[model samples]
Target: MSMKNLDRHNRWRNKTVAFRVSPEEDEQLEIFVKLSGLTKQDYITRRLLEKEVVVQGNPRVYKALRDELAAVLDELRRIEAGQGVNGELLDTIHMIATILNGMQEEIAYGN
Candidate 1:
C-alpha cells in the first residue's frame, strides 16, 4: 500500500487515553483484564469508547429478583438494628455486587 493509504489507515485506528486509578481498583481491573484476554489499557479504552444497550428484563423475573434483593437488604437492616452484623453476610453481599457489576460491564461493552 502507498504511504498515504497506510497513514489514513493508521488515522482510523483507535487512540489511547491515560488516567490514574486507585490501587484497589487497579487490582480488580487486573482480574478482568486477564479474564477478557485484553491488556488493562485496551480493556479500559474499549470499555470507555463502547456503546451500551440496556434491555428490560422479563417482568416476572425482574420482579422476583428485585423482591429477593429487597428481602436480603431487609434482613441486613434487621441484623444491623438488632445487635450487630455478620461479617460473612456482608462479604457475600460485596461479592455478589462485584459479580453483577462485572456482568453488567461485559454485557454493555463486550464484542
Candidate 2:
C-alpha cells in the first residue's frame, strides 16, 4: 500500500480515485497542469472540487506557456486551408487567453 497523504486542511487523504482517459485527453490534462504550475493531484483535486485553480506567475509556468503557444502555432500551420480547426486546439487557445488576461489584470492591479 502507498503511504498516506495529508491535504492543506490537515485531513488525511486515504482514498484513491482512478479514471481512464483517452491519450489525447491525458495530453490536454498534462498541459493544463503544467501551465497551472500545480501538481497533477492538486490540479485534479481543485478541478473536481469546483475550486478555482489560481495560477501563480512563475518561471516554470512561463516556460509552459511559451512551449504551448509554439505547439499551437505549429498545429495551425499544419492545417489545410479548407480543413476545419481542431476543437481541442480552440479550447487550448481559449485557456491560454484566459490565463494571459488574468495575469494582465493582476499586473494592472499591482497584485
Candidate 3:
C-alpha cells in the first residue's frame, strides 16, 4: 500500500456499539439529536463520554428571575443604608421568593 493508504488503514475506527430500540425510543432519540444539532454518532458518542447535552428550557423565566433577584438585592442594600424602600420593590421581592419556595418544595417532593 502507498503511505497515505497505509496511514488511513492504521487510523480506522474499529469498534462497534449496538443496541435495539423500539420505534418510540428511536423517535425520542432522533428528537433529542436534532435539538442537540449533532449527528447521531456524535450525539451518542458524547453521551457515552458523559458530556453535557444541553436542551432548551424556560430561559425567559430564568432570565427574568435573575434580573428580579439582582434588583431585589440592590433594593435591600439601599434599605440597609436607611434609604426609603419602594412598595413595588417589596412586592417584586415577595413574589420571587414565593415562586422560589414553590420550586424548592417541588424538588423536595417530586413524583
Best by TM-score: 2
Q: For model 1, how many clashes? A: 0
- The digit string of per-residue lDDT tens for model 3 on 1-111 reads 344433224754446689999876685566445444456776787798898754332555466567667767887898999999875666566656665676677778882
Runs off by more than 4 Å, candidate 1: 1-16, 51-111
Q: Write the per-residue lDDT of candidate 1 for residues 45-75, one digit (tens) a residue.
A: 5678793322223454345445546756986
The TM-score values for the models, in the order shown, are 0.35, 0.91, 0.45
| Model 1 residue 22 lDDT score | 87
Summing lDDT over every window of 10 consecutive residues in candidate 3, give the lowest-scoring window.
1-10
* lDDT to native, each model: 0.54, 0.90, 0.64
Candidate 2, pairs of clashing residues:
none
Q: Model 2 misses residue 19 by how many Å?
A: 0.4
Best of the two (1, 3) by TM-score: 3
Give the TM-score (vs. native) of candidate 1: 0.35
State how far residue 72 of model 3 sits from its true place (Å).
Answer: 0.8
Clashes of each: 0, 0, 0
Better of 2 and 3 by lDDT: 2
Superposed model 3: Cα runs more than 4 Å off: 1-57
